[model samples]
Structure formats: C-alpha cells, structure tokens
Target chain A: MAARKPVFNQQVLYDTTPLPDSIPKVKELGATSAPLFSASFFIGTRCKDYNDDYMQCKTENPGKGEFECLKEGRRVTRCARSVIKDLNTSCLEQFRAHWECLDDNNHQLWQCRPAEWNLNRCAFEKLGLEKVIPDQPPQSTPVHLRKKMIFAHYPIPSHAKPFITGQEEAKPKAS
Target chain B: MPQDMPPVGGYEAVQYKRNIPARGFRAGYYLAGAGAIMAYGWYHLIVGLRERNELAREKMWGRIHLIPALQAEEDRDLVRRHLADQAREKALLGENIKVYHSDRYVRPTFAATPGSTTK
Candidate 1:
C-alpha cells in the first residue's frame, strides 16, 4: 500500500477587525475581483488611529445614544475609505500582481513574497497616512461644486437622484 | 490342417487405435503467453511510477502556492466587509454616499480627475 501524505495548514495573515453589524457580509456582496487584500493592508496598517479616534469620540459623548456618536464613526470610516481608495488608485498594479500571485499559488504567502513586498512598498509610499489626519479632510473633498464633482467621478444610480431635470426638459410641450 | 483347425477354435485378436496424432501444443505458444504477461506487468510498473512522480511534484509546489493565495482571499473578504460597513454608515448618516470623495491626495481640479470631464 502507498503511504498517505500528511496535510499541512498554512498560517493565514490578515486584519482581524470586526466590521460594524450594519454592514453587509463580504460573502453577501458577491464580489469576485475586488481589491480586498490591498484595502485590508491599508486599513490594518492604520487601524490604531481609527480605533483611537472612535474611542475618543465615545468618551466625549458619554451617556449619549449610539446615533449621537455617529459623527465620530463617520470620521473613522471616511479615513479608512480614503486610504482604501488611494491604495486602489495608486498601488493598483502592485496589488493585482500580489493578488494574482497568491491566487496562482493557491493562496500561499511565502511563494508570493516578492509580489506581496512590492504591493506593501507601493501602498506605504502612496497611502501617505504617516501624518495624523482628520476623518474627512478639507482637501479630500473639493471646495467648489464638490457634490457635482463627486457625482462626475462615480456612477450614480438613476433612482438615487432627487430630481430628473433633464427628462423634464426633454418632454414635448403641450399644444 | 492342424493350423486351420486351431484358428477355427480360437477367437481372432482385435486392435484399437486413434485416427489423428495427439500432439498437445508447440513450445512457441507457451513462450508467447509468458511474453505477453511480462509486457503487461512492465507497462503497469512504468505508468505507476510516472503517476507517483507527478503526484509528488504537485505536492511539493502546492505547499508553497496555497498559503498566500488563501491569505490574499481572506484579506480581500475583510476589506469587502469594511467597505460594506462604511457604505451602510454613510447611508445611515443621511450623507450622499455616491457623491462623496475621500481620497485627500487626489488633485482638486476637475481636469486632474479622470473620467470627470470626458463622457
């Protein structure tokens, strides 16, 4: 009889922060190719700051309802989102390389060390989170026509729009 | 006269014999059968060894590749959950989730942003 091979489990390295209950689960989102690893790296790398801000907010708003402390929560979430976006934009190629390497190698971190290192280096240089930053910094949002600017950058569902002015204008005039 | 008298007194002897020769098989038949069995065994041995080698190779490379890939996948899931939480919070705060830009490093001008001016 042939000898049976022993199975070895590899160590899993990743952020362990629990997302708020309000957020949908990752499996439910059904994303196939999202920049998840890179985003986690960015968030995990700066988790301490986010946690500190949240704690401070909670302390300041003692005895207040959770809703009242939402402002602070928003700040932490905004900072994380900003960092995630920055990683996606700036270190996208490196992120893809690392991710692909892991996938090709069946999620082995050691085999993908080179690609992982590259992604980390790129994220560290591009994220620029070394300085203490606000939740939604002024520079993050443009001053003039900021709403329009944001809408122009991202795709907005038609149902989300408060008005349909273009359709109204295009309608034929009554005789 | 005496001989003829004796033949009439005694019964004639009868002989029993086969019509064809009883040769069983040639030596070459046994040799061919042995050769076929040996060839079959040799073929199985070679194939078995090759399969074993391939399996060993897969095991060796698989150990290196699988760990990082799984970690990467898990990390992505974590990020996805984080983003989902952020989105939910934005909605709860009555903020324009779709129209909010949070990257500070991005240039502030309309032209500096990609896909802003062009369709």
Candidate 2:
C-alpha cells in the first residue's frame, strides 16, 4: 500500500460499472456496527476456518490479495451471513435485545452483559455457537461474565430531586 | 505632642504570629502521611493500569476477530470494481487489453472515483 503510484484526481474517471459476467457475485452483509459486534462471536464460531483462510490468502498475496483472494473472501461473507441469518431466525428476540442494549451503551460488551447472556444462551441452545474469550484462564470467570463491571457508569439517579410532584401542595404546611 | 508616643509601649508588643499552637503534626508525620497517601494512590494506579491493559487486550482481540468479516465485505467491493473495470474496458475496446508490460498483477494505487462528490 505504501508503494506510491500517483493517479491525479481531476483526470480520474468514476466507474459506476459493476462486476462483469465472468466473476461470480456475492451479496454484501447488511448488519451494522452494534449488530455486527453482537453477532461477531457466533460468526467467529461458525466461520473460523473460512475467515482464517481468507486472512491467510490476503497475507500471502500482499498487494494483489484484493483481486486474487475473491474466492476466499466470498466464502467468509457467506459464512457470516449464514450465522446472522440463523441467529435472526432462531434467536431474534435475544439478538435484537442484545444489539439494542449494545447500541445504547456505546457498544461496550460488559455494559450489555445481561442482554448478551440471553443472546448467548439462545445462540448456544439453538445454533450451538459459543462465545469464548481466547487465551483467557479457564478457571476464572471471563470479564463479560463478571457480576460487576468496574468501569461501567450506571445511569445517574434522580436522588436529589423530589420523587412526587404536587405533594408539597397536597401536604399541610410544616410550620 | 504626646503623639502616639509608641502607643503605650508599641501596642503591647503586638503579637505578629498566629498563636495557634503548632497547628499540624510534626514534619516526619507529614512525610509519613504523604507517603501513605502516595502509596495508596500508586496501588490504585497500578491496578487501574493492569485493568486498562486487560481491556486493551480485549478490545484488540475483538477487532482482530472481526477483521475477516470486515475484509470480506471490503474485498467483495474491490472484486466487483475490478470486474466492472474489466467489463467496461472490454465493452469499449472489444478485447482485453494488457496495460502492464508483463502478465504479473500490479495493485491499483487509487480509489474508485465516485459518481458525484456532493451526494
């Protein structure tokens, strides 16, 4: 990527043109950031081999990987899409709840563990995909499974503010 | 002129200092207090640093795990464009023309131009 070959911007033309007939076609995955993060572990579970193969291809072909590794790339995409589809069909409620919580919490996994637990349970039961933190000690609870998250900031309490409105009028004056 | 005449023995030797009876602990005690506070702070700092490092590892692995799927998404687009360019050239020229000197692949350095920048 660092090897510079300058193509001046003004003279360059846009190619609205799409893939030719010779190359096989694949649909792009539609899951956005939070949803993707939510489903990522399951994708890793099912598509580990395909994902590794695609990465290996890219690694072996540094500059030309983008063009040369299209086959492996399609496989990775397909595998991820399958995982997402299976989750949607089998664990829709848990999946949506988890991703929504993640979206609300800036996508911090620990903040959304309750929802994640539900999702993980459903995924494991239905799809047999598990979420495991690689290289973590087997004896200790994973960070996600911990009861308390040290850094998470819980929602601010309305502590100082009155809980009931118009109660001042309802009650007789103290004086 | 009686004048203030030293105002009755210079105002009774006006006590210039705060007579608060050595307000704080001794110097050694202060050092001990400061050292204790610092030790406490350093302990928490190290714990926080280790937690942060662990979190960093988690975040890095999260990104690493996602890379393949992300790459696949990106690669599909690249493949489509490459094939599209090939098709476009063939349509215009009626044959696959070799731009490179040899048959070896050379990566394109520029991004695909968009149809309109404003949109």
Candidate 3:
C-alpha cells in the first residue's frame, strides 16, 4: 500500500496576524509534514492557564514568580504549560526546538542587541510586532496556540497532542 | 343553561372519561423513553467492544515486535513456544464482532462518513 502523503496549505505555516495592517510572519520555529497526534496523548487535559478563545496564555498559572516587566509594566509569570496528554514524541521535540528559537529571537530583538535598535525596530515593525505583542501583555496564551504554531512550521506527525499537561493528576494513566 | 346542564355527579363522570386518553399518552411516552435509553446503552457497548479490539491489536503488534530481541539466536524452540502462546491467547479472546465485514459495510451503516463535518 502507498503511504499517505502530508497535507499543506498557506494556513499551515503562518497564522493570520490578529493585529490590523500587517503580513503574517514565521512565528513558529520548527516545521514538519505530519498530522497532530490525539489529544489523549497530551499531558495536561484541563490546564487552568489555557485561554480557549484567543489561543494564548492566561495569567492563571505563571511559571515564573510574579514580577512586573519593564517593557509592559504588568505583573507576569514565566509559566506556560501545555494541556495535551502524551503528545507525540517527535512533535514534542520539534515544539521544544521551535520554542527555543522564539526565545532566542525575543532576546536578540528586544534585550540583547542594543546597537541594532533601528534594525530591530524595522524588523519588528515589518513583522507586525506592535500588533503581535500587546501593549501590556494582556495574558499569556495557553499552550494549544503554541502547539498550533509549532505544527505550522513542522508537519505534525499523526496524532500529535496539542498541549502537555503539567499537572500530575491530569496525566493519563497507562492503560 | 343551568337548568339544561347535567348534575354535579355527571360532571365528575365526564372529567374521568376525558383523563383516560391523557393517561394512555403518558404511559406511551414513558415506554418510548425507556426504549431510547436501551438503544443508547447498546450503542455504547458496541463502541467499547471496538476499542477493546483495537487495544488488543496493538498489544499483539507489540508482542510480535518484541519477540526477536526477547528470544535470541539460539532460542528457536522458545520463540516458537512464545508465538504459540500468543496465538492461543488471541484465539481464546475469539472474534468480538465481524470487524472486516463491518469495516466494508461501515459506509452503509449508521456510522458517520469519513471527514464528515457534521458535529
């Protein structure tokens, strides 16, 4: 039997920027050609921080201790956890990689490179930074949106869990 | 009209007669509700069986894949014995349902079509 081929469209890689007047950029780091695994495989089934509507993190469960950010003047926590159970191994790896890239990019764009402020400004403007990052980081997005972003870059393997539930009680028992 | 109307006793009789049909309708509604519950139970049973079968299939796949490493080069007899035990266990479980036939006829059955957008 012939193997099933991967499916891709424009929507696969880039998300429509919610901000007005901007082109979508490669927000996700890893790219794949596989389908997402089942939700049953994800770690956290019902994470408290997940915001279903905007697909972003909520402030419910902050990873970091509560602190005010200089850039946004809002109390924030570094915690962002996934809600899916037993996410596919491959997808999980890719997700971590993509996240690392985003973190690195954020450091370089915002904090590290003081000399390239103008270039960073232009890059941020072109990438629609004003729109993507809110004035005061309204709330952190849930992990699902991050997973969707990861899937956009990489072909999600079949049955990739959307989020990893960080809580122990939420984890699925091995049957 | 009071003069022509039936007595109070007759009024009670008329009311009793009117309630008979309503009582019958209530009984019928309860019976239909009971039947619907039974049908839903049967549907769940079928789904559970299918899931069990799929789990079993996965187990068998795992056992077969693990056999090569578990039984090394010099253990041909042990490998044969292990395979036989697995086959015996599978046979003991027997066929839960007609899986192949059901898959073939699934389209015509009540099951939803593939990629069906209907909730």
The candidate that wins on DockQ is 2
The DockQ scores of all candidates, in the order shown, are 0.00, 0.29, 0.01
Q: Give the TM-score of candidate 2.
A: 0.70
Give the residue spans of candidate 1 off by over 4 A. A1-34, A55-65, A100-111, A129-175, B1-119
Per-residue lDDT tens digits for candidate 1, residues B36-100, read 99999999888556444443443343332222233333333444434544565577886634443
The clash numbers for all candidates, in the given order, read: 14, 0, 35
Better of 2 and 3 by lDDT: 2
Between candidates 1 and 2, which one is better according to DockQ? 2
- Give the candidate order by descending DockQ: 2, 3, 1
- Which ten residues in a row are the worst by lDDT in model 1 chain A? A142-151
Which ranking of candidates, highest TM-score first? 2, 1, 3
Candidate order by decreasing lDDT = 2, 1, 3
List the TM-score for candidate 2's chain B.
0.63
| Candidate 1 RMSD to the correct structure | 26.5
Return the lDDT, model 1, position A16.
35
Q: What is the C-alpha lDDT profile of model 2 across A99-127, one tens digit per residue?
A: 99989988887667667777877787688
Best by lDDT: 2
Q: DockQ for the candidate 1 complex?
A: 0.00
User: For model 3, what TM-score is found for chain B?
Assistant: 0.40
Off by over 4 Å in 2: A1-18, A137-140, A155-175, B1-23, B93-119
User: How do the candidates score on chain B by TM-score?
Assistant: 0.35, 0.63, 0.40
Q: Report the number of backbone clashes for model 2.
A: 0
